[model samples]
Target: MAKQVCMGAMMQCSMGMAPSSLVPTPKTVMTSGVMAANIMDNIPIMNIPPFGMCQSPSNPVVAAATAAALGVLTPMPCVPATPAPWAPGAATVLVCGMPALNDSSKLTCIWGGSISINFAGQVTHDIP
Candidate 1:
């Protein structure tokens, strides 16, 4: 079973240089002092904060910077471009009428980065 994702959960992006913490909204019931999360909780900077620097060539900022640097790879500040919600969340669990976010769930950035949970924030809450 995967642990339910909650506020302060740690996440890392494939093209990111550092990990960022998940900031779930307060629209759902509390899991363990902090609010639990759902698939739709992914709202870019509001929920999913930046993951340090981004190295994806698909990102316009990085691409432009790299091109300006004479083909040298230039990493820009990571501003996660999550256009959609996390996938493969807890299908058996519901939060705010949506699939509850689980530790094993994955979120994709528009810049071709795979975001994954490094820590689920709490150990007691598990979901199928």
Candidate 2:
């Protein structure tokens, strides 16, 4: 059904308008095609790219824009701010000595948003 995640994997955010791609460094393991990623690949711009625009009110930019628009929900450019790793990762499957990133993995955005994996980077020829 699902499989491991790799670099350039498509990702989305709950408070984001469009999807973005994952940018991992291939810590522990890497697939034949694209380098596999782990939970440690949760960096801000280095690993996670922007998701079009952000719609969360908690974000300062969005908040300011909404305020300027007279209480209207005005979205702003997305700037991912994840300070931790993907939760509930494959603990048993270590990548770069850390938990391997799974397709169902979820990353949190500090601006009140949840990032999710839309599709793994690899098309075929993967371990699982």
| Candidate 1 colliding pairs | none
Candidate 2 lDDT, 26-127, residue by residue in tens: 454677566888888888988998999999999999999999999999999999999989987785788777888889899999999999998888776557
Q: After superposition, how far is residue 120 of candidate 1 from its true place, in Å?
A: 0.2
Model 1, stretches more than 4 Å misplaced? 123-128
Output the lDDT of residue 50, model 2: 91
TM-score of each: 0.93, 0.91
The lDDT values for all models are: 0.92, 0.88
In candidate 1, what are the lDDT values of residues 1-128, reduced to their tens digit?
78989998999999999999999877747787789999998899999999999999999999999999999999999988898889989978899899999999999999999999999998565688
Off by over 4 Å in 2: 26-28, 125-128
Error of 1 at 74 (Å): 0.7
